[model samples]
Target: MKFRYLVAFVSLFHAFSSWASDSFIVKDIRVEGIQRTEAGTVFSYLPVKVGDTLDEEKATEAIKALYATGFFKDVKLKSENGVLIVEVDERPAIAQISINGAKEFEKDKLLEGLKQAGISESRIFSRSLLDRAEQELKRQYISRGKYAVKITTTTTPLERNRVAINFDINEGRTARIKKVSFVGNEKFKDSELRGILVLRKPDLLSWFTKNDQYSKQKLSADLETLRSYYLDRGYLEFNIESTQVSITPDLRDIYITINITEGAQYTVSDIKVAGEPLLPEEEIRKLILLKSGQVFARQKLTESVKLITDRLGDDGYAFANVNAAPELDHENRQAAFTFFIDPGRRVYIRRINITGNDRTRDEVIRREFRQMEGAWHSTKNINISKQRVDRLFFFNSVNVETPAVPNKTDQVDVNVKVEERPTGSIMFGAGYSDRQGIILNGSISQNNIFGTGNFFSLDVNTGAINKTYAASFTNPYFTVNGVSLGFDVYKRDLDTRPLSRVGTFKTETVGAGVRLGIPIAENDIVSLGLAAENTVLGVFADSPQRNKDFVTEFGKSTNNFPLTLSWARDRRDSAIWTTSGTTHRLFGEVSVPGGDLDYYKISYHQKWFYPITDNLTLMLNGEFGYGDGYTGRSLPFFKNFFAGGNNSVRGYDLNSLGPRDDRNLSLGGSKRIVGNIEVLFPVPFMKDDRSLRLSAFLDGGTVFARNIDFNLMRYSAGIALTWVSPMGPLKVSIAEPLNDQPVDRLQAFQFMFGQQF
Candidate 1:
């Protein structure tokens, strides 16, 4: 009430002043109430001057302009006896700014952004600037999963001219998903909701993908989707009663609770059409799956809407909207729903324009797009193309818009914009294993070769068994067709005795290979390859006397090399980091002069990812591989199959799988398989390009001499932690065998670093 009265009093004062100050001032002008603003500055803005007429309108104009500068709390202009008075209350200026409770971000950087927005040291500060700074800072934090935070700004008057500003930030706590529970859901178990919810608790294998990090916004969106699920079925009155998030004492862990009132589920008891039914009611009703007596289901209703839209589309009614309105019978707990569809008009695509990819070639996008120029645009095709672009892994974001074409009625043009990301990398790394000890790896790889989005790679390493030199290149687009060509040359040394990790080495392989890849569809691919190899496997001096008898039996000066054929299909989001995918590879070799040469190997791997929170996740990776017709004799000795090390099983020594070696040491070969379950969490300390992640894993696998005989194959399990660092990824594991083996040098425990693969 006082504020209202002040407004009225100010208005009356202005009216009276305007009427009274109409007289003229014909003498020297004088300035009063001067402070931070110079007297000359006021005189420069005033329209009326000495010896000139002074009017109320001119004074009012001067006062308004000063206030518009946004540097004053109050402004007044008075003229008495030819003396002018211009007084103003100056806003406090910022003397300095300090920040606290920040760990991931630097104070200087945040201050710099604030300064750019006109809130800086030695400058006046306002609540507006503080609010804006808070939002900007939060956006920066939210992009990296710091969703919950608080910012408080304090201002203290300083001597002479400014106020000290402090942005006291209570970053609160990082929200990590601890548990997600669903109540009153008897039809589907909590496990089902866990699969549906995008958020999940962090797992030991979280390094591969971030599945943890709770975001209220994201959770709210998911809940809406769940509600839609219920409404679509026949529960017209379904509602989410409430959602609660409880934090632990430390505030680091959070539990999510969702309460839902499912209400009474209604089945479609009857179907009918009213008012302007273009098609037969029975025909349209037949398209819906809500049988007259079936139980209500939100999933089915949603699908029914889709069916109606697609049915309308077949009749060239692309701009049609089909909505299902369900009229419930509360007495019977049933619903008779109606699809109130409104088909406005039929429209066609006019043109398709692509933008935002200044660095990438336009043809690259055009090739992947299913919708063409001057063609009927299918909604399904548009979404599929979006998925295709997202799967490229070379773009940060891709946006597609279909703007109505001007000067062309009933037609639209599609515009696509792409933001490119760095697609090539060169990594130099070193890894250690119980078998290899420490190994040096130098590699240069390019997924988008020369900005064309092809692939080329060269890798060199000096490690146990895998000591090799390799070079390869690939072209995803060959002559504008979805064809790829790849070639590689490599030299590797293989040693069968794993116990003597420092083995009596074998000098065997000198080889080359070629591959060709062709795309079958947007979601499918096929690859075929051929390779020729020459190897002379050698058994070293430090071996059991059985080796001498074996050599005499084979009577080998050397064995002729074999030719290999390989085929594979990889339908995964990313080869290095796949959230969901299926990868299959089959490689075989046939020897020419090496006694009925034949060897075949098959490997299959899958990964399912769930993001429990922005910073934590659960990752389950399952893998299985087997080698058939692998006599180890049909191929060159050096070409024999083997497995071990960090990427294989940690508890056992590398390649110590199949039969015993020359010195009675286990050498892994033949049928082999493994599995991994891991949880990932963000690192405690580290600000990085991609927030560093840590994880723990439990992996198990085994090997067999021939066909899988579970009893003969050994099983091992272990716990390993991995760190995805800016510099590189680091991993360490401690493993043990299911069945104890005294001679097993690595069975007690194992530790390794670098990549799991």
Candidate 2:
């Protein structure tokens, strides 16, 4: 106790001496710690320089200003050697920022999102800034259901006042949906209504449907779906009143309820077309699908409006407007619908609009456009332009906008804005199959080649059993007259499936083709083309008949006309792997291989896509291909038809679906036909980026030696896995005999890779 009091007495004496004997008066000023900062800045912050009196008020303000610049960590004011001195610690400059454990985002993309948190590539680094960055990182993960994530920063000093920064991150498990409940609708069962909602409950096969995760955003969208479901069946006033969400005690689950109000049902009593017609009234009337005496369906009525407008647009009235409105007789419960149209005067496109092209040049889009200035506008030209844009993988979404000019009558400027998406990249792959054993393949090509928006490709594959090399090119805007040109050169050596003792199947071909394109309508394009080619079929191939007939089938193509009519049926698959439903795509074609003149050929293919859940989808495909001489002559060897393999039956080798001669080389399956089905889901262990997927499938189909009887072909079914990687979608499947064909193993599978289409 005595020592403490003695020490306190000494501290009190010193404190009193310091407070009493303060130094003040005129003094000089000195500044230090100034890198990339001006001395004048430091002097401005000081209330008085060397010749002014030193005081506490001036020192306090000076310190605050110096700190506000965010360039200094420590600021001080003192008198030394009869001069007032200012000292500071400058912030460390940023040398580099490295982020580890990032898969969902690219490095540059991650940096862009981090700028809001006071972190940047070219700025300084601070502990406070790091704390903010950690919070941002946490938020990004939480948004994706990764709530158990951790982020840490490491700062290492470097030369020249700069520091290297590294952020180590651990992204933990993604929260999954436990169950889902829907309430407040008695007309439809819970199961029926849930099917309409894109968000789904977890199932054992949820890996395929990805229906395990619940998102409020998806739920809100489901509510809209519910409303549309009712409205389509005459529930004109159907409404979703509100939605409520509740969280579980564990904070791992969420329950949602949607309250709805279903209005009265009604039948259509009248149909009125209240729009100007650019064509015959009867012609426009024929386009209407809605009729009296039928129930008012929201979808059908909406389609009617679109059809009417599109028909008008085909006639140079590109700005035609059509709207469907329902009038209800409350007492009678009858609804009358009117399609209002304003076929504003026929106008030509003055200039085409192109946007969202960061890497692609303006000429790229302009080159593919079918419509030009000083030409009459037509919806056919507009749609053709859209197809050209769609072929550019550089865009995630493309949209057309036509805003009316208030004073300008009969003319509209077309705006074609696209949401640019990354298209060019490299891919490397390796996979094993029963037939091919182990296959390795890769390719590098630009979909938007040379930024001209023209399609050009040079792809090669050399596997244990398969070798292929191909070069192809396509011009969307081949000429000002609306012609499109395509040409290809290729060679292949394929090992037929079932591993028959027959030697390897080989093909060599070179060709150049031209098509005369003519617009028929908004959704129709007709083309005619001719080609010259030289070909030879190798011996001991899948079928020996190929050599028997091929010597007479090589030479000139007559005309390839109406050769490309693509009909696609699709159900959007939010996830491609582990899929459950089907989307159907059908294409019809007529072409010529090599005949003197006007040779005709035809083909058709149908694909179905069905989704079982958010994570799973089922795809069924059918194709009918054929070619013959128009004047009853021999068809060109290369232009003749054949089908097999992963894209067709999944159990056969590439182009190995026809008859074989005594030596076992394929002649061909001129009237080729095939069908198949597949089920896809997500892969476990791989990060759930959605861009990556895994799947299993069963495919059964066969080529017809004769006409497509639809019943003569064999069937094969089995399973496989897939990965929709960033570079491409890789598919691997195993197939087995379903029809008991004389085989121990229909006993094989195939691998496929597709990037764009």
Candidate 3:
């Protein structure tokens, strides 16, 4: 193709040179040989116009300009009898594009990539462009570790000077890492350094993890990790010299080698604070993590600077600057550091600007902000505001920035940017359990309705033993002062044959409730609610003694009115995967005097999380509940609390841990106590991912009807996997009971899919 273009250019140049001495003027221009390109486009590229003097040089210039446009393959200029003729061969347009044999990537994604490479339909086609596009596709495959990928392109000519381009892609097996070797490391072994990296040699779990796949991005990130590891281990002058990635001849295996310079380790000899002390020097020193005689760590130094700056920011120094200057002592292998603080002018927020929220209302995001507009800037408040917005789960990302106002030294603007995510979910799931038989459940929920930050859900569950239908809605911001209003209505039908020894009878309940939440503090909420429910119990000849007595005393139908009061304080950093925080909730529900059943139930739940390491967290959760009849009525049997489930004791059957009836059916208790201690860690080979977690837990709980016996608690130990999958949140556990009785019900494996916990 290049040779043909070259010949055409040479021929046109030679033809123009022959007429160099002859010049023409006052002539009309004519264009020919253009099939798809408009005549106007040809004329626009022609340097010489009609009625303008045209010489051999002008003719040559016009031909060259036309060819440079990339719209034509050949260009010729001719002059006869004072008339200039411009002739060109337009490039063919791409009519269609087809890709085949591409499995690793979606068809639409490949098409979009081709479009970005100027190889889409209805565009001018050239052989050079096509070659470049093929190379680009190959690069994309290689980035995904598909080194054996082959791309073949063919063009079929069609009518009207258009061609159909097809790309035949053969995406072969991905290259796996065979070995990773490090060089120039004396203090740390190769295995130690490799453990710090995400990329690794193929292992038993390679099929599930894909960690052995060679990815350029992952390699780059691993290099950064290696650097950080050294810097945090007192190697202040560490540097990665070079890295080499090698693939086998067949492109199925890969080997990586990284070279580094492990500089001399240093210890901190002294630490000092310098510059203007806007606050007490002792207070600033308390924030420093560095100490004398300790090994110098770059991470700790950086953290110390950040803490000092944030401390100043809390006192209205929004633009404070803090720097750590190190003085190295080569002979002694010691380093002295001085932290310099610059408390810039105390700034006030001039305005708060919110953007990138197209679906959500501005007020919905603004209500989460703690830093008010026109108030003194506080970094603490700004960070809290960002976290609060994140907790809403309405946005994919929330970012806050402070930009100084023009012409104002002491004023700045707070810019909160959020990227909204889809907050509506529709889910359906089916499960089969030995106790419940076949169960089908579905739900439609929206956390953000019409950009109002309201939550609405419709839930339905149907099983052989149980059936329930419910709808609920909550307005998180019912008022400007952060009050919340919510309501719920539900109908449930329970066949007691499976779970209760009360004969083959059924119980039905219909209920409705309204609740209000008042915000007492930033993290505290007090709730009040009232509900009315009517219960109907069916009796049979084989009914149990307790059920027969209840039906005979209260009749087949009974009505009750319940009032609820609750308070909660939540300080979790994240709602989905909390690593650090504490949450406490206490609630009480009491049936009023005029109801058929008068009882009060009180419960307390407390949870705390402590970060054990960067990748591990320790969590403690405890729940206690107690209920009894008030005035003269006994506690309703249906209101009893049951322990033993995935959310309680994993090794036991659902709601099966308590007193048992004559037929060995679980009878729930009026007192409940459950506690769990878990260590949450990142799943192996997926440490960088936040959507998946693995936990080892110890759970103990028991329920009592009359007296609480702490020694009667059932203990279980288990390993759990939680994944925030695209379908929904999934939880799976395998557990073993430590203390199991002869008649105790045990379930070793429990799992729930397409549901949120």
Candidate 4:
């Protein structure tokens, strides 16, 4: 019996030990070795709970779950007295990151990039993440053509299981494109192709353009441009075989080679329109730019499709589609095309939504919108709405979209969004001229005061020769039909004692006026104004006889009533950065019977801009002014016209081109003529920046005391720069007198800085 009991005891003890080795019934859970993480946090990630059978698979899964959290570098699980204990060796957190020897990029920008790569401070550290950060840095440098950049990283262990990372960089020279060549081309010269490319060898403009730098993105874009050039010129079968970019061993120079096949040019043999005709077939055919016997241009074909789709869109087909299908005759080198039109549905605008206008009232934007709710969606109206709002100059950008309404097949919503800009400004500027001396000026103006779309301004200008104080207010929408009302009060003082221009005299005037503007057409306005003024003239012995006679006839103090009539037509695409269109203004001011002086002044001004290319514009501006006395009275010399200034003909002294007195001093003129032809383009290498402009201009103008003489006109040619800086619009010109007379006072360099109203 003693031997049997011993054998049973040994077998039972072995079985109990085997069960504990394979699995366990957990009674509790414990987490250890975590520094910043809480025990409860580890328990939440634990796949096994207490009182559950914890086996080998469950323990492995639990360790994987904790490890995947990235909070720990190692995890181990064990069971003691039916309690599962999770032990984790937490990874070190990043305490700080520093970069050294970085000159090409901002430190904060580099830190932002590293943060995107999961290597920022306070984040868990990992060797793989560090490698990723290094690669990101390399990518940035490579994009900038810095192919020889070297980056070395160091990580130091810190207290509390933390790490500080440092990146030492050696940014080398930028790899420039040394050569670009073409292969397998017969029709076009290599020079022509290279000229069309954005990438080029170093040139005078390379310092600003950086076009000499070799970049994959730039190369790819060049390839696309080259392809487009071919396609637009009837090379429909052109194909690029291969492009090879080779860098020198030192990575400081790059060579690009392109192989292409320019197949035979094709002509359009025939054209037809297919599918449902939303409009008359003849009308649709008229919209097609490509005709039989013309070259097959992809650009023209694309434009034809767009025209058709736009026409359909105007007819309420908001999602119109037009695709041009081409049939080729390889032997004849001719192509026939068909436009398939798909007018999906007639859609109406269910609602008009406005957004991003925090300061402006909803009605302000709504009033500018031509597209109305509950009406058929019209692309033309929507575009007009966007243009109207943009022309206000109150917003940086205006975007419009017609998104289809959910669960509705024939309805869409117009979403008009705007980005408001600073519409109010306090301007302070100073300018100096030989005649005007030092001119100091300031103004406070708001184009959209209190978001009401009204304009208010107070202006003050003081100079050695002139002083003016004025305040004006305009309510653009005083009436619902776009009639505008404006009021202004002003005081002007002029002292010509120290100037050699005109007669030496002093004058003080005060005036108040009210004006009404009536919108006569979509782009035309008629303005009528009435003002009353009182003038006091100080005519001394040294004054000109002409001025003394006028003072004697009209007395030292006199009151005058003036009536003003003006008409304006503005069709420019934009008031600022105008690239195309024309503007015309016809103005006349007449002193009525109640005034001490009876005179009239009439002027006509016109401006036209033609876009020669995407980046080039041709502008033509002209102004003609004529003034004379009525009722046999003489015209006031002070009201006469003056030319030869920065605003008129450059390369001459300010207000210096006119009839001269016997003393050779300039006498004001009763008539003036000014004309300018300017070729405007973006500043070299700064095409993307819209605030700067450069123009080559030719100017011709002259002022006449009585009769006009074109032969007496002065001419100048020069280059001008316009920069819309934070302070104001700054203009500088360097001109050469083309046809200056002996009496002309030449001024080659002129600049003016003033804020826009």
Of the candidates shown, which would achieve the greatest TM-score relative to the real structure? Answer: 4
Candidate 4 residue 70 Cα shift, in angstroms, is: 1.4
Residues 1-757 of candidate 2 have per-residue lDDT tens digits of 6974675456434423333224566466777777866788777765666666556565555666776677776665556666666676778888788899976557787787777788886686777777778788878776665656678888999876778888888776666665556566667787888778876656666666555566667777877788889888887877788777665655566566777777678889987767565567677667777778887788887787788777777677876788877788988889887877798788766677788888788877776677776577777777777777776567888887666556777666778898887666566666554445655666666667666666777777665456677777777667754455767666655444334533234455444545455554433456555555443445442444544344435322122232444443333333244243344444444444433433445666655666776657666666666666556655544455655566666666655556554555444656776766666565654546666555565655555555566555666777766565654566676776555444212337567654322
Tens digit of lDDT per residue, candidate 1, span 313-365? 54545667877777889999988877787755666778778877777777777
Give the per-residue lDDT of model 3 (tens digit) for 237-331: 89999999999999998999999999899999999999975989899889999999999888899899989988888777888999889999998
The clash count for each model shown is 38, 49, 0, 0
What does the lDDT come to for candidate 1?
0.66
What's the lDDT of the predicted structure labeled candidate 3? 0.87
Report the Cα RMSD per candidate.
7.4, 9.7, 4.2, 6.6
Q: By summed lDDT, which 10 consecutive residues of candidate 2 come out lowest?
A: 554-563
TM-score of 3: 0.85
Q: Model 4, 123: alpha-carbon shift in Å? A: 1.9
Greater TM-score among 1 and 4 belongs to 4
lDDT at position 197, candidate 4: 98
TM-score of each: 0.72, 0.59, 0.85, 0.93
Query: After TM-score superposition, what is the CA distance of residue 388 in candidate 1 from its true location, in Å?
Result: 3.3
**Model 2 lDDT at residue 672:** 73
